[model samples]
Target: MSHHTVSVELENKPGALVRISQLFARRGYNIQSLAVGPTERPGISRLTLRVDCSEHTIEQIEKQMHKLVNVLRVVELLPDESVERELALITVGAPPDRRAELIALGDVFGARVADIGREALTFEIVGRPEELDAFEELVRPHGVRELARTGRIGLRRPGPRQSRAQAALT
Candidate 1:
């Protein structure tokens, strides 16, 4: 029942997302959040996935994913490793009376007000999931009219850069 984040490298091609998502569905696993975008490498895209599953099930899924034609690699991100992660949150309709207080709380969590309107204010925060939870708890009583989040997007840290020689070999 633990939550896990996995990084999958795949070929940039049509129906790639559909194929991956369908694998999870067919296995009865729930994807908490998914982010897909191009990587530095040409013709390759990276998918950051947060899903809830057991280690055994995840291994099964990884093996299944490798069997697909487009899948290049699947690596589960471990917390102990050097990694970079970010998330953005938006809160609307913040009570005017608590504006200063909410703003201060956001400051404590390294968040900033992104937009302001007569009836609403949008705050954008980029950080780990735990940081987002703390920010949400601080602003909950201050009239959070709406909330939206982009779940963890990240990559390994301090890894050696691939030289042209190494890249060509791969």
Candidate 2:
């Protein structure tokens, strides 16, 4: 099954997340990644979910989400129409001799040194999911002490709109 990213708008209230999670469980759809946060509008939250399912199953899931009380909106984030990102904090063993090496590696991957301990260096990386994965692999040989990844969060891209004049020109 391929992966699909779904964006949901939920009411910012207690038990809202529970209801959604229960629905997924009941449907036997495993969530690969989920991120939830408040939106610009008060009393509303946005939930981004990554699930592995077929097109038919995803459609059914979306329909079920629409019937839920807390869910206000449900939309599949098509890759071409959305921008996605994930954040990772990786703590790798860094001996004094290897500190400069790791730092240079971080520079190539756009990661920053979040913390610099004598034996460990915590690097902060923010990028697309694949980019994060590549960084993780590159640093694994250094002996990772800990790693934390904030699952993907995404928003639809606002492409160029055709105003009246633009439409006329086109």
Candidate 3:
């Protein structure tokens, strides 16, 4: 199975998200990551979803999504031509003796110390999924007390901005 990232634009109305999830459920497709937020345009929301499935399955999902009333557009964010990111917050048990060492490691990963307590240190990191994984590994030995990751969100590289006349010609 191949991993695919799908971007969807839908009306920001009640039950719109539920209906989309229901479509995936009925088809037995598992959503790996999902992010939904308001776009620059009001009354609309952009959804970024990551799924592991074959090419044919993704095509079928998109077609079914098109049949739904709320969905406006759906597009795939190809890895080669898109930028993807995820954010993670990690709280690690830090003894007084180990605080300095942990902070140093976090600096190496471009993580900032979000919070510091006598016994725990909370770090915030934003990067590609793999980078987050590496940071986790680096802190695992120190005892991770809590962790949260905002799943993959992505956008395609800007190809070009077309003027109204250019769009009409195309």
Q: Which has the greatest lDDT?
A: 2
Q: Please, what is the TM-score per model?
A: 0.87, 0.93, 0.90
Model 1 Cα lDDT, one tens digit per residue, 1-170: 78788899999999998999999998898999898888999999999888888999888878898998999999887654435356665665665776777678778877989988766787899877777877777777667878887767767644455455544432
Report the lDDT tens digits of candidate 3 across residue range 49-81: 999999999999899999889999999887766
TM-score winner: 2
On a 0 to 100 scale, what is the lDDT of residue 130 in model 1?
74
For all candidates, what are the clash counts?
0, 0, 0
Clash list (residue pairs), candidate 3: none
Give the higher-lDDT candidate: 2 or 3.
2
Q: On residues 1-170, what C-alpha lDDT tens digit does candidate 2 reach at each position?
A: 89999999999989999999999999899999999998999999999999999999999999999999999999999876677899999999999999999999999989999999989999999988989999999999999999999899998866644355533432
Clashes in model 2: which pairs?
A: none
Question: Superposing all C-alpha atoms, what RMSD in Å does each candidate have to the true structure?
Answer: 6.5, 4.9, 6.2
Q: Would you give me the overall lDDT of model 1?
A: 0.79
